[model samples]
Target: MSGLNDRILGLGLLVLAVAYGWVAQQWPEPFGGSEGLGPETFPTILSVVLVIGSLYLMVKPDADAQWPWGKTALELLVAVIVLVIYALLLEPLGFVISTTLVVGTLSWRMGASPGKAFLTGLISAVVVFGLFNYGLSLSLPAGLLEIN
Candidate 1:
């Protein structure tokens, strides 16, 4: 039963991986002859990783795996909801704020204290924002925090 479930999940994920890789390939050529990694690089890499992982799952699944129940299932649902809301809010609230909200909520739900969770989220969001915006030259949406 678990093997069948794993195979089904793997097949679904494999389809998603292929689609994601294809979409990544559709990105327009970067301005400067593609000297550095472009927007598609990360997604392509992620899709490849997902494909490998899905294949592994399909090939060898855990025989004793059990599905989440009750509170565990509810927690998973909440996590998914948080991720969806985060995506919707990203452009409006900006990367830092949206990431903070999502990360803090998940951290708190995972048993961290509210204060610690929020602080961690804030620090992490800031660090990631700085890294992507400055170091990687990838501009995350500033939205409400726009400097202009």
Candidate 2:
């Protein structure tokens, strides 16, 4: 069962790599330089590496490997739900509130203490906001916290 799952995942990765590679190759390179590679070059190379890694996994799957399919699926489902909720509430709740809630929930789901989770979430949100808005001078929507 595990071997079959591994093979399936490996094949899926290979397919994804091929599809991404094709798309990357089709991307227009308007900023072509005389010596340096264009933007598409990195993606093309990454896709090739993904394909190679997947192929290697297919050929040499670990015998002792165990796939926690149920746990992984539940985690993924929860993550998707959290992301959706965050996106829906982002504008009304504001970046700080939405980000903190999402991060804390995710951290709790990942087995962190509630206090630690909340603290970390708060700190992370502030740091990210500072980096993007102040450090990088990126214009992020202030949402509900917009000061007149």
Best by TM-score: 1
lDDT of 2 by residue, 1-148 (tens): 5466667779999999999999988866555433345546667889999999999878887667775589898898999999999999988877887898999999999999999998899899888878767765544557777898
Q: Which stretches of candidate 1 lie over 4 Å from their true place?
A: none
Model 2: pairs clashing at backbone N, Cα or C within 3 Å: none
lDDT of 1 by residue, 8-106 (tens): 889999999999999999989888787477788778999999999999989998788899999999999999999999999999999999999999999
lDDT of each: 0.93, 0.82
Candidate 1, residue 112: Cα displacement in angstroms equals 0.3
The numbered model that scores best in lDDT is 1
TM-score of each: 0.95, 0.56
Q: How large is the C-alpha RMSD of every model relative to the true structure? A: 1.2, 5.6
Q: Model 2 off-target regions past 4 Å?
A: 1-68
How far out, in Å, is residue 62 in model 1?
Answer: 1.2
